[model samples]
Target: MAAEAIDRAMGALIGGALGDALGMPTQLLSPTRIAELYGHVEDFVAPSADHPVSKGLPAGAITDDTEQALLLGRILVSSGDRFDHARWVNALLDWERDVKARGSYDLLGPSTKRAIDAINDGVPPEQAGSSGDTNGAAMRIAPVGIMMPPEPLDALVAKAAEACRATHNTSIAIASAAAVAAAVSSGVAGSDWRVASDRAVAAARRGATLGHWVTGGDIAARIAWAQKLVRGKAEKEAIRLIVDLIGTGVASQESVPAAFAVLEVAQGDAWRAAVISANLGGDTDTIGAIAAGMAGACSGLSCLPQGRIARLKGIDLAEVRALAADLVAARNAKAGSGKEAAA
Candidate 1:
């Protein structure tokens, strides 16, 4: 059971990076543009020369989605069960500096950049993220899910909220992050994909009551609607419906639900989910990362293509595996103690 937990944890981490790398070249492009330029993102492909954020990045390089996730994972493992908001903010700032120094245009997302700027200008960390409603929180929340358990779901939602407090404290943002985190947690606990998706919706509902309220579509409702919308549709048709109606932008309402929709279309196949999300256009890397993370968590590392996994570059897989092991150990410790773990 310990080994299986570690495998799923590693799957969540590696699947997120794989999806991020696969979507690096397609992010920010329109579906038509992706179709015209790359046909369909079946594997890692270098970003087009004029690509705004990821231009000049190599084929198998991960973007901020995976980088920030790994950063959060490291923090979770080292900090034990407590989530340090200041440490998270400082880490993000340091990460952005590194990204700039590397000459990569893929810097911080809007929500994170805004919150960090506000923090620098003397705004409280909790207040700084009150207006953020993007998918930044959800995109990087896989680590929280990995370290936390799914039952006593209120605890899971609260942990997710704490993780989002530094940069994405809006109701929509918290709910979105909680949804993804719950799905990942459920998957790590060996739940099936459908059960995980149901938990995601439940968590989203609970999470929506916390954080500053913002005007947006309900994340939980949209996730349910998205799954139903794509149930019996062909892959191409499902992708088109998700792109046109469900949307594929940075909004938590759009991207988070869109990810679940993609997961449904792929039937929880990690590699296929990543490929579909890569060709999904608009916030592709984030959508891919979220979808693939949940899928991998449900299906484990075995669901991934080993050849493509071997081709991945830049990110440290050994460290990811270590973090997974640590997180699983932490979970086990909490379970053995029969006590609630701190977030």
Candidate 2:
């Protein structure tokens, strides 16, 4: 159990990195083009921006998936073992808000990048996120599940939804963020994929506001539908359906559904999931990153390779370390508070 716990945690981080780096080269490839270019991006290579790694990343480097997740991890440490929404939001805001020191170019999704740009221009933070519906929130949300306080799953889901407002605020985006966070947390708690999936869907359902663009039903149903659509269909056809049926790219509609669909495809194979995620075309890196993180959280770290971790860029490494340290600190604080989840 201990080993499994560790591995699941490792899965989230390593899987995220693998997906991000692999998709970097083909960030904008159409599903058909992706299949033609590579059956699936299986290895770590620095794809030129036009190629895949083009999201302003270095060879063998990941994107905001690792960076933002690390930020959440660091805040969890400061959270004293439980969530403090303000602190979490502030942490994310600080990192992305101070754009003078930009993270890797093209690292942040358009919604988040635009929202931050709005905040810098004097828009209130709350209003800043109103327009963002990109996958930015979903892509970097894994750490919240990894180390959140153990308690009411519903409340945690709400928190996750609200927490994503630093960048994303649309109901669909918020729900997607909650799903990823809840799924990761369920994996941490040793639940199976179905349990995790149920919790994730339930969380999204709860967080959804009336008249929200994407229904909980839409997100959940699409997973099954994408699988059926891809059956005997060419890989390109599968990718197209993901774009047409589920969406690809950064829109919350595209990101969350695409990630879930690709996740279903990856099933239990860490490498296969990550590779296919990138190959599904639109927002390939983001989809791959989210699925990969979920895979890591559900599986164990042993399923991933150490070489990939070593190959990630130095900046990303430092960010993840900070997040991990925060996770440990959060546990310690919870212990001191007499309510640590570990107890």
Please provide the root mean square deviation of candidate 2 (C-alpha atoms, Å).
Answer: 4.1
lDDT of 2: 0.66
lDDT of 1: 0.91
For each candidate, what is the lDDT? 0.91, 0.66
Give model 2's TM-score versus the native structure.
Answer: 0.81
Residue lDDT tens for model 1, 236-334 = 999999999999999999999999999999999988899999888999999999999999999888778889988887887788888889888887775
TM-score of 1: 0.97
The C-alpha stretches of model 2 lying farther than 4 A from their native spots are 1-4, 35-40, 49-58, 79-104, 149-151, 210-240, 315-322, 328-343
Question: How many backbone clashes can be found in candidate 1?
Answer: 0
